[model samples]
Target: MLKEALAFKRPLIFADSFFVNKPERVEMILFLMSLCLLVYNLDQRELRNSLKRAKTGVKSQICKLTDYHTLRFI
Candidate 1:
């Protein structure tokens, strides 16, 4: 298994064909998510402090909605 191999530095390459529009939707979602997370953490001190203080809270739980979206492909 690649996980157990420890020496798994094998180089791999793809022909850049699948790098087109099909997976762009997923990548776009992640990009937008990243941007939202960036702007959100930037604009709100409360959110930052909440993240700093939380083991469990609704604000922290909000990412789980996006996780469900990401999980849909699997």
Candidate 2:
């Protein structure tokens, strides 16, 4: 993902260097901003999934511990 983002950005940076006009620069800036936002959203989604998996693992462990304790009492 990082590599892809860098690939997308490199051409735009090169283009910006050649184009000095206001409108084109504005368009390029907007494109870069949107690209950054997209990358950020993808990162956030990955983080959320990881946290969810961790939560599920912890819950299962707790359930197993509780079941073991209950069985011991019986």
Candidate 3:
């Protein structure tokens, strides 16, 4: 899961989209990314909980119904 989450943030390794030479800058960027990932996971959990409480589900990528939708999908 950790690997997938990190890969999701930066899809392409050779993209060179973000370049930080300084250690402080790299640390800051990592901190921000971690915070954002935390928020994303929390939001997904809340959505899943709410759907379960409501006894409803959204269609998944396979076109099947699922209340425990993944954070990466939906």
The number of the candidate with the highest TM-score is 3
Lowest summed lDDT across 10 adjacent residues in model 2 is found at 65-74
Per-residue lDDT of model 3, residues 1-74, tens digit only: 66766675455444367788899998898798789889988898899999999999999878888899766676
- Model 2 per-residue lDDT tens digits across residues 1-74: 45644454553355445545598778888797788668765765565566566664222333552211111122
Which candidate tops lDDT? 3
Which segments of model 1 are wrong by more than 4 Å?
1-21, 46-74
Q: How many angstroms is residue 18 displaced in model 1 relative to the true structure, after the best TM-score fit? A: 21
Rank candidates by TM-score, best first.
3, 2, 1
Give the alpha carbon lDDT tens digit for every residue of 1-74 in model 1: 22422232435323342444668776886586568655644545454455456544332244552211111122
lDDT-wise, the better of 1 and 2 is 2
Candidate no. 3 TM-score: 0.75
Off by over 4 Å in 3: 1-3, 8-15
